[model samples]
Target: MKAGVFYGTNFRIGQSSGGLPIIDNDDIPIALVQGNRDGVANPANAQETYAGIQDPPKAFITIPGANHYGITNEDNLIREPNRPTLEQDVAIETIARWSALFLRGTALKDKGAFDYVFNSGDALDPNVSVESVTKPIPEYTSVVSLLGLGVIGASSLLTNMQKLVKKST
Candidate 1:
């Protein structure tokens, strides 16, 4: 997450020439798929962040026995598997199913078809997910990513300085 915003929240849109005034609020309906293994934006804190959302109605689903990337097919990424059951495939399928229904409903205005999504406000699993709204929203911060940018920039500057020194020599 950058500047207190959640990870992957830094999105931008441009006009034909990529000029503004930029339109931020498109009032798009959203469906939140929270991995049980994903400590960030877990169901509970997700509900809180979602509650603060000014966009259209939304849906939040927490797939049990999974982590932040539970939707992926990486079996080895499982957190502490010896403890709770890790239903990885089920979580992925569940997310796909909910996304399809939610998007279809949003597009076709078929609220009745996706009414179950309204229950997104429900409590999160106490053991794995965040149970308190007061805490910051959990996110998968790419530590290497944040550091890589600076490292790369510094390397470029040093390389240029070396080239200039050799040229002058």
Candidate 2:
């Protein structure tokens, strides 16, 4: 599971200082689901990112008591007791439901799904726990993982290059 981040609001594809690309289709909505319990992707990060977008398809969703990867299932989550508790299943359901609404504009069939997703709780609640919910993923693993990634990245690049060569030929 990879967490992708594009820091700073100014996303420029061209030479000019363009703010952001206009969304042509509403179906391909841009959204961000931030975990209030996560310090890494904090409320500030969400606010800044939301501010950067030129036009928003939907309001950013803030899941109460979720960590950085709150969108994923409970098995993938690490627990921190001091924080506002979130059920693992609820976290998964919330993300799944929220994503469905944004990317497909399709609402979750479950009765309370839409209402649950729309409940954007307090982003800057000072009372929430600041203790680390999860440890550093790479740090816990062997350095060999880094080498494995390099190999994978290189192979991926090569595969793409081969595809481009075939297309040109």
Candidate 3:
């Protein structure tokens, strides 16, 4: 999945300098993983950004008791001091699992991954709170489907063109 993943960051849209288009305008799925205790980027800003995205296949995941630096090895409170109640290892593992599941679900088009991220499996994680918009898609049952038909089709066309060029030469 060509998903845009944001971790404890904020972007200003519609500004003259360094502004971006509305998040919903993006075609790819978006996931924002925020720590509840983040001081660098306010959690409220994350909420606003998530609200701006008016499309399905989007996710807003919050890690409870985690600070802005919780995703990293240690929390640095030099600029924005916020204590994390969650342990570093625990937060990292939680983030890693969810991120992987999200990628597997959207990019690999795996039904189980989809179920975990967009469906009921997310509830198993007590430390995470997820709000998402998602729709059902057909299960991909083959290696070709896993690779995506568009990719394979393009590769085949390119190979055929190369063969024709070789024969001409």
Candidate 4:
């Protein structure tokens, strides 16, 4: 499960002779974090890039009331003035938490994290607006996997039974 994280990314910057490089890559799972109030990097560019992805799990998270420099410690208004309702600390914390969850879901294959990121939990968060595309869980491709799960379950049951027997004795 190869995965990637991008924060405040400008998809429009590419040095290719053809101008902007293709944003679509179906092989790697990716999480892109953006600020809805960003004045520097246009949110439209991120939206376009996210739309181009055809397959593989992907998440686009827009931090509400955050600006382009929200990922940073402070926004230097001289570089890019922004109107951000979210404080820097709050924005940073939100980005960190979501990014970690995204990595755990995709890279570590953690079901709880995956569920929150790609399923219903993120929708309830007031700080973010999430758009996600999920690859279906691959079918069990081999009998070994089924057998392995069965064995683990049996072992757990046996251990619990032994503990109960000891307590009764």
lDDT agreement of model 4 with the native? 0.82
Compared with the true structure, what per-residue lDDT tens digits does model 3 show for residues 46-148? Answer: 8877877766688888999888887899889796588999999999888888888888887778889878888776588898999988855557676558668
Q: What is the C-alpha RMSD of each candidate to the true structure, in Å?
A: 19.7, 19.9, 10.2, 12.4
Could you tell me which 10 consecutive residues in candidate 1 have the lowest summed lDDT?
1-10
Q: Summarize candidate 4's per-residue lDDT along 1-169 as a digit string, tens digits.
A: 4788887775564422343446566578888899988777778777777776666698999998888888888887886677789989999999999999999998899999999999875667889889998976657766678888999999999999999999999
The list of candidate 1 runs beyond 4 A from truth reads 1-24, 40-45, 76-84, 119-169
Q: Give lDDT per model, in order.
A: 0.48, 0.47, 0.80, 0.82
Best by lDDT: 4
Over 85-125, each residue of candidate 1 has an lDDT whose tens digit, in order, gives 56767656665665565565565666664453443323422
* Pairwise lDDT winner, candidates 2 and 4: 4
RMSD of 1: 19.7
Query: Candidate 3: global Cα-lDDT?
Result: 0.80
Model 1: per-residue Cα lDDT at residue 114: 40
Q: Report, for all candidates in order, the number of backbone clashes.
A: 8, 0, 1, 0
What lDDT is obtained when candidate 2 is compared to the true structure? 0.47
**Could you give candidate 2's per-residue lDDT for residues 1-169 as a string of tens digits?**
1121221122332234434444343332345665677644456555555555443234465666766555554433244333436765677676565555443332223434323333322223322211111112466456788888999999999999999999999
| Clashing residue pairs found in predicted model 2 | none
